[model samples]
Target: LEAINLRERKIIPAIKKGETVVLDFSHAITATHSFLTALLADPIKILGLKSYKQIKIIGANETIRTIIDF
Candidate 1:
């Protein structure tokens, strides 16, 4: 949770500046719903759904992709 907060700190600033953020999940096999929600909570709250435009997710497997879609 602390790590997620730290990452959000960096991501929010960049997104505010209109920079694209690439989230690489190459080595990650899967993620919990809570994890993804926690990861995105701040950006979605602060920037709204439009924040999705600034976030690029790569290397996510089908299941992870599906989870993210949910």
Candidate 2:
């Protein structure tokens, strides 16, 4: 929750201000659905699809990619 809050307050604002945001998922070998939702879902909701058109996600494995893409 703390991590999510920081991203919400800082990263989301940066993205909103027209900065490019790169989210690297390499450190985590696996991500739970709840973790992914908490980490990313709110930003998508707040920023909308148009804003995320250029966002980059790095090093996600197939399962993670499937969940995220779905």
Candidate 3:
């Protein structure tokens, strides 16, 4: 609930650009924020939700941010 509120208010702190975040949804769904926008963020993935669009439908546990260098 808190995270949703934070995101809604655009008060998210600096999360790493290459870290997998599994949003917690154990709180009230009515007040919880959907992790959709998160999917578009770099190094971010919408956990616990079905993958679609540009998101991959892999297991949350297996999902990770891979930064490649050449």
> Which candidate has the highest lDDT of all?
1
Give candidate 1's whole-model lDDT. 0.80
As for candidate 3, its clashing pairs are: none
Q: Per-model C-alpha lDDT, please? A: 0.80, 0.76, 0.31
Worst 10 residues of 1 by lDDT: 2-11
**Residue 26, candidate 3: C-alpha displacement in angstroms:** 0.8
Error of 2 at 26 (Å): 1.5
* Candidate 3 per-residue C-alpha lDDT over 1-70 given as tens digits, one digit per residue, 9 for 90 to 100: 5335554333233232332334433342222113434323322343222222223323222122221110
Error of 3 at 68 (Å): 29
Consecutive 10-residue window with the lowest summed lDDT within model 2: 46-55
Q: Which candidate, 2 or 3, has the higher lDDT?
A: 2
Number of clashes in every candidate structure? 0, 0, 0
How well does each candidate superpose onto the true structure, as a TM-score? 0.84, 0.78, 0.25
Off by over 4 Å in 2: none
Q: Which stretches of candidate 3 lie over 4 Å from their true place?
A: 1-5, 8-16, 32-70
Q: By TM-score, how accurate is candidate 1?
A: 0.84
Badly placed stretches (over 4 Å) of model 1 are none
Q: What clash pairs does model 2 have?
A: none
